[model samples]
Target: MKFDVLRAHQGDKWYGVGDTRDAREVEVQHLVDRGVLRKAAPDVLNKAAPPVQNKAVSAPKNKASK
Candidate 1:
């Protein structure tokens, strides 16, 4: 479980108790109680960032009428 949480942290993802390998509420609670995993800040997970606009070339438009 520790490994799983660490993996999720490294992957920049949130690890919820319901999404753990055991998938038991108690297990997740235990981790939180033991300080193995803590609730991540909202900004850390849902920060307002600029959208990634595509700057690639566009496809040519068809001239024929369908």
Candidate 2:
């Protein structure tokens, strides 16, 4: 079952499982040992990536503005 979850999320940042953190970590490690999944880079797992910060415009500022 654990292996199935890992396989389903082969290259995802965090497999969407509700298991405890320790259990998830162990499962991930097992998958890695079995050459089933690879660890994602730190940047890839950045859960706190800043929300899209587009500049706020009060009104249309383009040639097509009405």
Specify the highest-lDDT model's number: 2
Pairs in clash, predicted candidate 1: none
After the best TM-score superposition of candidate 1, give how far the Cα of residue 26 lies from its true spot, in angstroms: 16
What's the TM for model 1? 0.29
Q: Candidate 2: TM-score?
A: 0.29
Q: What stretches of model 2 exceed 4 Å from their correct place?
A: 1-5, 8-21, 24-30, 37-45, 60-66
lDDT of 1 by residue, 1-66 (tens): 222342343223565443433335554666567655555444465467889999997766765632
Q: Candidate 1's C-alpha lDDT?
A: 0.49
